[model samples]
Target: MKGTQSLERALDILFALGDDGETQTIAEIAQRISIPESSVYRLIQTLERNGLVERKGQGQIGLGLRILELAKSLNSQFRNRLKSSAAPLMEQLSEETKETVVLFVRTGTNVICVKSVAGQHLVRFVVEDGKTFPIQNGASGKAILAFETSKIINQVIHTIETDLVDDFLEELQVIREKGFSETSSEVDPGIIGIAAPIFDQANHVIASVTVAGPGDRIKDEKLSAIVPHVIKTAKRISSSLSFSTTLS
Candidate 1:
C-alpha cells in the first residue's frame, strides 16, 4: 500500500476495533480488515506508541484510555459551547423558578443530560451531567421527540415495546401542539419535569431544555408560572444556536 493507503488502512483497523469493543489478536484484526498479519502488527505498534491502542494480553489489543482522553476533551469543548450559549438564560430561569434546569441531547434510544443548573432550595431534583435515560419516558424525551418527523418517530417506536407505541405517539402529538411537555412523577416519584424542544439553524430539534422540581412545590399554580419561562428559554437557546450556525 502507498503511504496514504497505509494510513487509511490503519484508520480502518481503528474503526474495526471501536465497533467491536473487544480485544483482538493481530490475526483477528488482520482477518477482519483483510490486511496481512505482518502489516497489522506494524500498524498496531505505531497506534500503540501514539497511545491510541493498548495491549490486552499476549497477542491481543484493545482501544486505549487515550481515546477516552481525546473524547473527554472533545465533549468538554462541545459542552463549553452549549453552556456558553445557554448559561445566562438557564441561570435566569433557575432563579425565577427556583427549580433544577437541564439541557439534554438525543443519543440513539436515549437522551444524555449535557448541562444542568441546580435549584436554590433545600429539596430539589438535580440531574448530573452525562446522565442518560430512555427517550420514551420523560419530559425532555417527549419535548425532543415532539419536533421530530413521523418517520423518525416510527423508527424510534420500532425500538420500544409493542404495547407502548400508541400512547407514546399520542403524547408526542400533545407536546407538539403545546410546544412543550410537562409531566409529574414519571421518571422519578415526587418530581415534576417541564421541557421544551430546542432547534438548530435548519429548524431541526437537536436538544431540549428542562426545568424539574419537587412535585409538592410544582403544583398547578407553580407549573402555570414556570411553563412560559421554560418555553422562552428553549426558544432563546435555539435562536442562539441558529444565529451562531449562520455566522459560522
Candidate 2:
C-alpha cells in the first residue's frame, strides 16, 4: 500500500509537469499535488536518478533526456506503422491525380511529411519525405488543425500574427465543415494542394493525406476533380488505422 501511494504521487507530479510543458520547482509541484515539500523532494530525487526528470536552472525541474529517448522510439514505431498502412492508398491517389501525395503528422506546432509519393508528370511539384512546415499554413496543416482540440487550436493561434488569428480560426471552421481543405501558394509558390484529415480509433486527427501539384496544371477543373479523391484516400487511411488500433 505504501509503495502504491508513492507511485501515485510520482505520477501526479509528472502529470502536473506535462500540463503546460514548463519547468516547475519542488515547492510548486508539492503545492499542486497537495503533498509535503520534503516528500516531494525525495520523490523528485528518485525520479532524477532514474533519468525521468532533470533540474533546470533556478531550482526548477523538467522532463529529462530519457523521456525524449522513449518518445523518439515510440514515435518512430508509430510513424512506421502509419507509413506502411498509408502507402498503397497514397500511391493510388498519386496515380489517379497525377500529383504528389504526402502523409503528414503533427509534431508540436509543426506538420511533418512522413511519406510522399511523387507525381507522374514532369512538371509536378515534389515534396520529399521528412519535410516539416508550420501548422499555420497549407492545406495539409489546415486539414489536421481543423480536427484538433480547441485548446490546441487556441495555443497554435496564439503563435500567429494577432491580425491573422481570427481569419485563421475561421478558416479552420470552414475546413472542418467542408471535410477537406485546398490552397494555392499557401506554403510553396506556384503550387496547389488539397488535403483531408485521418483519424484514429478514438476519432482524434492523427494525420493528413495531401495531394499537390504545379499551379499551372492544377486549375479549377483539375482541383475539382482531385478533391474527392484526396478525401477518399484520407478516409481509407483513417479507416485502416482505426481498425488496426482496435485489433492491437
Candidate 3:
C-alpha cells in the first residue's frame, strides 16, 4: 500500500541517521537515498512528532531519548522473565550444593553475572551481581566459550591481549569433551567454580550456570559429585527456555 511504503521509507531514513551517529540535513539525506528533499523533510517531521527523531541544531537531526526508553522497558521485561524462571532453579541449586550459584551471559568478550543465589553454608565466596569477567579466566566463561561457534570463540579470543591463545584453546577442547568446565582460584583466590552451558531451543549457548565455593570444599571428589547435579540443573533451566537437551 502507499501508506505502508511511506512508513517504511520513513523508518529507513531514521535507521540511516542512527547508523551515522550524527545529525544530517534534509538535503544530505535526500542525496544519499536519492529521494526528493521535500519527502525527506515530511518524514523527518513525522518521526520528530513521535519522538523517534529530534532536530539537533539548525537543519540537523538525530535519534531522540524515546528509543532508549523503549529499550529499557524491553530489558525490564526480560529481567522479570529471567527472575521468574531461573531464580527458583538458582535457589534450588544453591541449597543442594551448599555453594554460591550464579547465572551469567556472555556479552562481547566478557561474561556478566546477572543472577546469583547464596548457599546455606555460612562461609562462601561471594560474587557481586552485575560483575563482568573475562572469557578465559573463569569456569562459567569457559563453559560458554566452549559451546559457542568457532567464529564467536575466535572473536572473543582476539579481544584478549594475551599469549595464552593456544593454552585457552586446549582447555576449551577439554571442556568440550568433558561437557563442563572447572577452575580453581583462577578468577578468585582460594575459590573453585564449575560451570555448564545453558543452551537455547536452537542449541545456541545463551548463558551458563555455575557453582563456586572454597577450594578445599570443592575438591576433585566433590566436583565429581556435583557434576551430575549441575548438568541436570542446567538442562532444567534450558528446558524452561524451550531448549531440548541431547543428554541421555
Strongest candidate by TM-score: 2
> Residues 168-188, candidate 3, lDDT per residue (tens digit)?
888999998988899988899
TM-score of model 3 (CA atoms)? 0.70
The per-model lDDT (C-alpha) reads: 0.89, 0.91, 0.84
What would the TM-scores of all predictions be?
Answer: 0.69, 0.87, 0.70
Q: Ten consecutive residues with minimal summed lDDT in candidate 3?
A: 239-248
lDDT of 2 by residue, 1-248 (tens): 28999999988988888787899999999999999999999998988999989999899999888878988999998899999899999999998998899999998889999989999998888888888999878999989999998878987988998999888888899999999999899899999989999998788999999999888999888889999999999999989988888888
Residue 136 CA displacement from its true place in model 2, Å: 1.4
Best by lDDT: 2
Tens-digit lDDT track for model 1 on 1-248?
Answer: 78999899889888989875788999999999997999998999899999999998887899998987997897677667777899898999999999999999887668899889999998999788999998877899889988877766777899888998888888888999999999888888999999999987888898899999999999898899999999999999989877776786
Error at 10, model 2, angstroms: 2.9
> How many clashes (backbone atoms < 3 Å, residues ≥3 apart in a chain or on different chains) does model 2 have?
0
Model 2 residue pairs with clashes: none
Q: By TM-score, how accurate is candidate 1?
A: 0.69
Candidate 3 segments whose C-alpha is farther than 4 A from its true place: 1-71, 243-248
Superior candidate under TM-score, 1 versus 3: 3
